[model samples]
Target: MYEVIATPFLEDFLVMRPGKSGGFKIPFHRYQELRDTAGDRPCPEWLAAATRKAWGVELSGRSADAVLVREPSSYGYARASYELNLGCNYDCPFCYLGKKEFEGLDWEGRETLLGVMRDAGVVWLQLTGGEPLIDPLFRETYGRAYELGMMLQISSNGSRLHDERNLNLLTQYRPYRITVSVYGATEETYDRTTRRRGTWRQFRRGLAAAREAGLPLRLNVVVVDDNAHELDQMKALADELEAEHFVYSNISPTIHGGPEALSSQSDEHLRARKPFTGCNAGITHFHADPFGLASICKVGRDEQIDLVAEGVEGLAQLPPIADKLMLRTGGCSGCALQDKCGTCRPLAKRYQEANAPLVSYCQHGRR
Candidate 1:
């Protein structure tokens, strides 16, 4: 088993340890030198010393296999997010996924999908879902991705973090980070927001257990009308756990273009987003839904490439698709404030389709 991964990140080379965040960036020559060394040979002196200093792991006598060197790829994506399943235990009205249908590929299909991601040069992979931890094949999927030399991150609601089996598995094979969503600080408010009676207790227990286990955690403070009054309390709770956190106030329409979720947005807490800067969504990163449909990003699901059927070769179609999606052609066409608009095209289209008021996403609405 490899302890470190030497892979090509976008335009640079990196030497990173498995299950850890942050790594050392090396020049092409240095990467080449390490790659040329035989895998069965003893670990290189520089690498051994670096690992000892950085992670306190002594790689002195270990063979070069201690470091897995990934081959460079013509495919551009270096990061991707995969939805393992869409089933959840709780029902939050503000969920953008709309329908929480529990359906996805079988284990064999999942393995093949992961293989395609690896071949496409995905180095940083995020495992997410309605509740990824509850997926029946969570352990198998996570283990396979780790074995394929991809650093893993997870997004969850934190309801199952207290389970002994989950805690044990996560501790043994660490994730770079687990991002948990915080609906409210108090039990009543929390339960009301999720529309689940006992979720507040489970979430609290899970958070405490994860903190005690010394896991890297980040809290996404989901601000909505139901929990808006508890914003400060929520932040305090995150601080009490000593976890990193950020506030999320903007609410979007459901994936099917329904405006129902927009009603939950907290008016007072909502703030304008930064200018619509270009992103590498489809260019250097992509999102895979439960069925292995690859799209430019989560919001732009209009055009999807079936990775399960076409494999990595299908990724070639994404760049142009990304370009086309970014253009302001519909309600946004011929607008003078295009450069100042904060929302991206695909997202804007969703709001327009839902007949959302201008103030929700338009610069003119703010004026």
Candidate 2:
């Protein structure tokens, strides 16, 4: 009966509860008071009252008291990313999924899979892909996941999502959030980046539809060489639309471990990559592709474990490489590239090119 709680002011805090998406984020003093007052008992009276008062949820009948602790790991994964389908209408030159072939579980199969993940202690599930909404079973699959008490997030290109039918379907399930990747701010740039005519207009239409429906909408401005010049316009567009949130992403790599994507990466962006921002893949995050193959992260997508054959238990058997920051072999081993190394080790290893040098992203070359 133990529950996890979070405070609005603090970072993500977790209590040792299973399958619960952490508790409400209340005020600071109130959070401290609840922590101080809570005791090991059937349930704390003050904590329950505080929660009810703060979040307007009655927890009196609940069996166990809630507590704040470090976020859970290992057996309990808080979030899982699923590639719903590999079918995408627009073909971007820099696609990392590598000319994805259409694949997805049928409705019954997806339903069973969602149940398995929920039972395995996953509370937040992100539906992503070449384009999640393109799949025929996406709506039903999303609805089933939400009904299973899993907080749902979706990553989309906004093509089909702009359709009135698809918008209505998404509105029905009411996802926690949806991220629409904006390839470019203008039609020319957008078309160039996505290599598809009419996508920019469709993207705008989708954004408008999402906003009108009051669905939580965020923007992912995929900054690539093709659309690098319009980064400011993209941000301005997001601001004008009053999106819930927006972020820039230029770190995506080519599928074959090439530095072509890096060629267009800005100098500022390269310098920004100098920090050791760690990865949270196998540690607390996991990704499963459309074929029911699970990987530690997007970079490790090729190194997949068959989720259908092994189920969630396969996650336990996955290699614990999430913490690895430095390559033990290859040209990068003990090299002075340090923080400025833009070579993704997983991506390098994916194409049998581990420790290979990438001059386009190396600070050593500039030095």
Candidate 3:
């Protein structure tokens, strides 16, 4: 699909600042550097076309900085988890999706999901699951998703894409983002971690199919202790495929290093957990499960602290879940990281022993 596939510049972007000991680290220099570099680069013609088709925007008013910060949430004008079930078949110990049997909504429920996305003004509809390719409704749901005037983004385990029918159904939409999960670059480590045989091979083939289908792909490398050293190699592969690469933040906690404790073979330094260290979950982007909605990180979906429909748009609904959002160990009230940190409640509970600060994050003094 990409015969000429000319390389693109990676210098125009910068990583999000990691929280430092003194205070939240904001890389103003990198931020400014990106802003200056952005104006010089001609935005991709395809991206401009995608944005215009999805949201009917001129794409001329946009800036690169806005693209980076909100890119995770949307592809351009389209923003949402539309057509998404967010389920996963593999039990990656570190998966923030947590463990659950595959579940999905009937047609009516699916419409409700779309309704919320419309309310949120989403232009791109993402269809994810415990491997969306495995869903029985895959073709029908996918067709309907694009019919809603939302560009399709599909996240898959890559195992089933080998089926020509499945591949054909997906390629028909002309997906804007196709994310495939690959834990380890090498087959041994990848298969061992997943406890499933031939996963890496299937993943590679799926990626090939995506490229053949002319889909823009992004590869997700969950950084665990095993694959941490090859992070550069993974990035290299991404470059070779001309696909974007992302190192997913760990979902499991770091306080405990046992197999169960260490969710995967990635290298992730735990971020400090401070009570008053505020999170942008409810305010910025919230996570929702079937029951209701989680106010904090996606892992906190089980806790179901806040309902997305309860009238909280941004920072206003945090107080309702304040207690559940607290640090169990030192019980921080005003730790500075409170505002900038993910403060993933599950990480704290999973990593720390009963009533402890999350192992991956900083501990505030007991209130």
Candidate 4:
């Protein structure tokens, strides 16, 4: 909670290099419009410092208790998410991980990843995928991830969670937390948003099963044009479910296609690459394709910075050449939110490099 005054203000953020529609240059004039109608009394105290740091030294307005911490790194009572799987079942138009050349993944990638985790002393493994539950490799991957003595973070569409057998299996795997997509408060909305039928029921069943199983849970909602108006309803559903935590954010442009590519996209998109502003890839974490072709970010899926070879071991393994394979590079140097944006490198190809800086993304979103 913070303060709000009558003042006009504006600021630029970053998504992926390209905009949302797989194209990059996205001018979110909405911020300017919002500021003009906003007051300048004082932002909440919590948000003041974060705003200053992300936007650079000088910020005229006050603040609030917004995001300004390193919490997005490692979650839970304790542990960090070692990346796994990239394919997802949903294809909301606003999805960030563009339709990449995902095909016949060598399951060996998981074995290699497990080895890396063992060497790095990683304790928590985050499981994601085109649909991790559906993947035939999950049985092996789950066992391996568990064998590494790491807590697993399972993020899913929630459709599979409802199966009693699967739910029991999940219990055996002992995932630390299950983050599910909260696309809508009703089935009609969810089915349309996910571009599939009968998904809403399955997803809800999964979430309920997880909750009943007492798996610590969090809910993620992608706030977009089609659903922003229903923010309250979404929250209400979370409350009804008694979720431990619920988060809402815009679809990131950091993956394959940027937000602009989804111009015809609906608002109920889900998040692919976790949202962040100043994406210091390899500095702390690395992204990976199923085959274990590590990328800097998810958008400009490049191959230059493959950490899998030497593995995310000591600092020396990650050379000084921190190229923008996934995180963007162009417009970043001059952007006000440079340190706080999820500037994906892939976005460079999605949109004209000229307008990257003027873009906006959720800065280190989790915190």
Give the TM-scores of the predictions, in the order they appear: 0.98, 0.75, 0.61, 0.63
Task: Give a tens-digit lDDT track for model 1, residues 1-367.
Answer: 7888888998999989876899988899878877888476788888888888889987754456588888888896899999999999999999999889999989988998999998999999999998999999998999899888899999999999999989998888889999999999999999999999999999999999999999999999999999999999999998988889999999999877889899999999879989998899999999999999999998999999999999999999999999999999999999999988899999999999899998899989989
lDDT at position 174, candidate 2: 66
Q: lDDT for model 4, on a 0 to 1 scale?
A: 0.51
Alpha carbon lDDT of each predicted model: 0.91, 0.65, 0.51, 0.51
Q: Best-fitting candidate, measured by lDDT? A: 1
Error of 1 at 360 (Å): 0.7
lDDT of 3 by residue, 1-367 (tens): 1101011112222221111001112244534443454543654455446445544544443344223321112211123343245455565666545454556566655555555544443444456666778776677777665554455677777777777888787665466677877677788877776667888788778778777877677888666766666667777878889887876645454223223535452335333333444454433344444433433444443244323344224323443454455554434445465555444544554444333334444444222
Instruction: Indicate which candidate wins on TM-score.
Output: 1
Q: What pairs collide in candidate 1?
A: none
lDDT of 4 by residue, 162-192 (tens): 7776677777656667777777777887777
lDDT by residue for model 2 (116-217), tens: 576556767899888888788887888777655566788999877778777877776567678888888889999888888998888888888888888877
TM-score of 4: 0.63
Q: Order candidates by TM-score, high to low.
A: 1, 2, 4, 3
Q: Candidate 1's error at 366, in angstroms?
A: 1.6
Cα lDDT for residue 75, model 4?
10
* RMSD of model 4 against the true structure: 17.1
